[model samples]
Target: MLSICKIYFMLFLYLSINLFIMALYFILLNMEVFIEYNLLSFNSLSMVMIVFIDWMTLFFMSFVLFIAALVTKYSEDYMGLDKSLNRFILLVVLFVLSMMFLIMSPNLISILLGWDGLGLVSYILVIYYQNIKSYNAGMLTALSNRVGDAALLIAIALMMNFESWNFIFYLDFFKNDDMMKIIMFFVILAAMTKSAQIPFSSWLPAAMAAPTPVSSLVHSSTLVTAGVYLLIRFSSAFSPMFMDFLLFISLFTMFMAGLGANFEFDLKKIIALSTLSQLGLMISILSLGNSDLAFFHLLTHALFKALLFMCAGMIIHSLNNCQDIRFMGGLSLYMPITCTLFNICNLSLCGLPFLSGFYSKDLVVEIMSMGYLNLFVYLIFYLSVGLTVCYSFRVVYYTFTGDSNILVLSTLNENSKIMLSSMIGLVFLVVFMGSILSWVMFPFPYFICLSFVMKMMTCFFILMGIFLGYECAKFSLEYSIKAVLFYNFSMFSASMWNMPFLSTFGVNYYPLFLGKIYMKNFDQGWLEYYGGKNLYNSLKMSSSSFQLFSRNHIKIYLLFIILWLMFMVSFLII
Candidate 1:
């Protein structure tokens, strides 16, 4: 009998292959299918279940399932010893199902069903280890995503004006309407939180507390990209002003994540920050009105990022769960296959020539160069690209080329065949998927007209990044304490510009302090004095006065009668 993990692996792989073929068929035939089932109707409003199938949805679903299959297979070996391996597999399958629902749905309600599902399952996955750190990370992940859920719910409510919940049909038609703009604003907000852009970004790195396979799936194609996918679907609806706004936000996010990753020592967190950075790139390009490029990058990114995480998992497993890159060195000497695969994925992430990342990332930069944008935007864009390379190379130097910092007695080797096989399966895609996707997605090449200097700008940045990365990773006694000189600035950048603090303690502090004040002054103080206690005292005093009056009433009545009779007698005598 097949184990639960193996069953899921086969199931997901089969689904992925079929979906890929279906996606190709849809693309070639230029076909889209919309299936709607009416669940209820109330006075012109209908609650219906809708499945909107097109090439984009099918393609995305294929990639998601493919990654899911590999991650599941990889987890079989990585998590082999865990007693609840079956439960873990089940959670993964459920997560994939939710992602499929999200990919296929064009209606707000159905999308929420999948959106909420992803958020919920991700929290469970993040806290899978049952540790304090995992619990905190899970809470941060869930609460941060809840903001997006709220935004999506508001968007759904606003869509009620159109009498149809399907947003695909209305996005283009209502582009100029004020109500539509409000709905799209909420949609953008939803995407930002889901994608971990800027203020909501604290959760992405924190979510690395999850099991590595879950991180592989979540960061790659499902949780984070859901926002980008939603934006792609609504790309046509954004006004020029909104596009510019989104562009700035995403660019800043890209820059911030890149900077953070350079300072990050945790293996999983470095990768998580990289994922966040790529998400920013996707959204930034999408903001520039090139959703196709964004989606293309999204697909290519999913392939290698998933493989990258699997490699990280293998390393961590061999090292007995040590994730700090500072403690790792010269891994290439011991685990040649894993280290080679890791470098390939890392370089691919840097958009090195001919890799899966290059086709999309290079195109994005080229396209952005052609845009009629300001100098600041251009500078930030290029700088962020360089930062990407810097961190990629930095990670490689620390883990693969540097002297081994691990224990002398430690055993490190790539002997897990099941795990390696899964990674090997994805390696081919990391090498060739970008070129294949570029050809299939764009039959005609984009016109390029730039000065030689401008065209060579990307290469220049990459080279500079390489040099800087090496210097950053080089160990020297003289400069060993140099970081302490700028400790404050280093801390600021390393902590994601203090976003986690702001998102958590910074956000919670004032509100909680005010609540405490209210509890003291109102609930316990003035309200207590004037409300229940005061009322009780007033009631008691009134009851005592009434009792005294009642007891003396008869005596007072007798005195009154005697006085009246005396007055009557005196009147008669007079």
Candidate 2:
């Protein structure tokens, strides 16, 4: 029965894949299809739904569906014979549907609908394990995203001032308007939350409590990239102040994530942090007035990052669910295919020349260099790049090259064709997507005239990063000089400047305290007194008065009527 269900689902995904391809054919022919309808209207405002399909929509939809199909197929074997297999498949499919809604919409209302759907579905997926850790992670994920959802709502409300819920129409008209500036503010705030930029970033690593396939889908393409896509759509209307603010935050996020990844010991958390760093890079490029470059990087990164997570999932499964890299070593000896895929993904992450990440990442660096940035910004960008390379190599050394670190050898082998099949599909994209996107998206090559010194710095940083990574891994047996000398600082780096603690305890303290106050002062106190107790007392008093009137009988009623007639006669005489 399960096998039949899986076959049917796979067939459905394949059908969707073919549909997207047909859409891509139209896109290649430069045919854009836009359709809109008014669902209802009230007092000169209409509830509208807009679907805009251009080259970007078709291209992105193709990749998204392709990956979803692979992941769904992969999950069949990866999940084993769980009791909730059907539920898991259902949630994954719903997640994809929500993402498709997000991809197709151009109106603010439609976007919000899709955005909130992503949040709600992701929360459900993250807590699917029903364990304490997953519950906590799900709450964190949902709450963090709720901030963005609220911001989206505010942005939508702000768009009401323009009398149109469709933001696509206002991009050109409101280019320099002050009201649009305010709207962009909320948009940026919303983007920051979704992208996990600084302060809101701690939830991302914590969210690794989810299943590995969910991690692959969430981190790589669907959830996090929503912010980048939103920004790409609104790029033309961003003011210079917005750009500056975004650049600062993005650089900080990139630097922070890189530092965190270097010190992280958990395998999944390390990869999660790396995803955060790439997200930062995408936003930073978008900040530098190059949304095209950011979008390109987003696409390329999705291909490789998805493959990376799939590889990680296989390793963890093979190792009997152990996720510590310290316990994993010499994997190349047992699973050569997995190791090769891992290395390819990691190298692609480092933006190695000619790979998928290289085309976009290299262009971004060069374009940033050409811009007139301050010394601090320039150094942070280059340093972050170097950190990226360092950590990529470090991960490579720890997982694939070292001697066997486990006490007893388990049967670690990649015999599952379903899992390998998904990874193999992505492998081709991880290798060629850079060139493919470049040829199709850009009509002209990015021509930059830079000095030899500036161009050489990128290469120099790569070498330095490699050297530093080699030395760090080479001295694993020896005591770390940095750890010994600066214990406090080392701990800070490991804890990501206490950001996790701050985001968890620090954020919770105030909210929980406020909730208690509300419970005591309002919910338990005034509300009870005024709404419950007072109403009960008032009703009781009225009942008692009625009883007294009834007990008095007909004589009192006649006396009252006579008194009323006498008063009326007295008024007429006056």
Candidate 3:
């Protein structure tokens, strides 16, 4: 009963957000409703006037209210389904609120608060099922996020040291090249970790342990978009180093995840790699500083990716009774609506002509063609795009088509009406989003739509992947084992981060066992054989004593404690 009531309330909220945003959308998404506001003391202002607002504020506000609705809808169905629904809903709402504040925050301090809030919420959501697997994934997300958060924090401290926390004041803070470089370094680091760029990307796939709705929110729109938003926000401050970072990270991640997705067997894991790869596409586009294209891609990607994810959720939910694609096959006939939605969503995701991704993504491609990237790097990107088609089609194929089309999938379709409705709505977007976007941008007109030679390549790969999946279906067992080895090795290597070192050594020195000297610290390379990790462990175990003694000195400990609090207080105060 409580679940039902929450669903009703959520529906009410969703409707309200739609009504409110729709009223503004005709006036906003079309016109220049993105007002940059100025503020004076609220003391003399009317209650309404005292509340400052802008397009960004509206975006945040609408997003939160809509998410609240989605949560309510999700909650009504998920209640009593997952053991930790209460905490999950709490975190979801809190996470939405956090992103809301982040979108409107004109200063860094408020954004950090939102950033941290999402992190905590994501952590809780990931562990909502509360098993050893979920716990480990949650911990991984927390620790990895800190790498990004720490960078942003260091950058913020440096900025606040010189100038106020106002966006306008950022120029003053970034006047010195060294300080700017430091800030860029930290921001890039944070962005990399947050964005799940390669070497740090393994966590996202692991995060599939999270429930479907949580995955929908995190993977589709809110959490991952933060990194892209950061890059867009700080477009001017980016230096050669920063661009190099973006260029390399974006290219490498796109290629890596593209390759990873081709080989991944876990249903959610494939989508996870796809998410990282597409995000890499966005980053590569953003690196060109073509804001319009990047922003449009952001909007388009938001729709199709969310649609695709929700569809993926539908597949996973219906078939995955705690099992993944490893257990799922031949589900097309039972869940026809879902299968059809998945196909359209993937077409859009692959930038099918006259589809949603075509205009915005192609715009990025067009712009990059005019940029400084070498031909080989561009070739790698184009090939990655081909991989997108391959995996997107593979996901659809494995889930839907089979040598025996009408085969009974052992899973039941238990999707709630609200979940089905959300899925349907996203499908609507998948089919018509290109038309909707055509009005806003020039990618597709009513009579004609955008398609390049790239679409032909995508088509080729997708057709090949479908045939490959079909042929490979016989060798499924062997493929699964090999896939497990490859994916696990990649994941394990990512956890170790020693592969880059080895790659370097392979290039420079012996090609076999070619590990770097520095990476000897990360892997049990020499450590497991010789007691390197154990030796480090012993030092760490006893190092606390050395640290405690230093800390136990009255002046030192007191100063340290005060300084720590001081650091925190200054951030909040800023």
Candidate maximizing lDDT: 1
Error of 2 at 215 (Å): 0.3
Candidate 3 collision pairs: 148-190
Deviation from truth (RMSD, Å), model 2: 3.7
Q: Write the per-residue lDDT of candidate 2 for residues 1-574, one digit (tens) a residue.
A: 4573366457656765776676557757878788978888999877667899887877777777777777888888888677888788788878878888988898888888889888999999999889999999999999998999998888888888898877887788898998899899999888899999988998899889999988998888899999989999898899898999999999999999987787666889889999999999999999999998998899899889999999999999999888988788899999999999999998898888999998988899999999999999999999999988888887788889878787585879999998998899889989997997898778688889899999988888888888877675555435555457555554677677798789776888898999999999988999989998899999999999999889997978899999999999999999
* Tens digit per residue, CA lDDT, model 1, 285-350: 999999999999999999999999999999999988999998898999999999889989988988
Ten contiguous residues with the weakest lDDT in model 3: 46-55
Question: Ranking under lDDT, best-scoring first?
Answer: 1, 2, 3
Candidate 1, position 166, lDDT: 81
Reference-based lDDT, each prediction = 0.91, 0.86, 0.67
Per-prediction tally of clashes: 0, 0, 1
Q: What TM-score fits each model?
A: 0.90, 0.91, 0.74
Error of 1 at 453 (Å): 1.4
lDDT of 1: 0.91
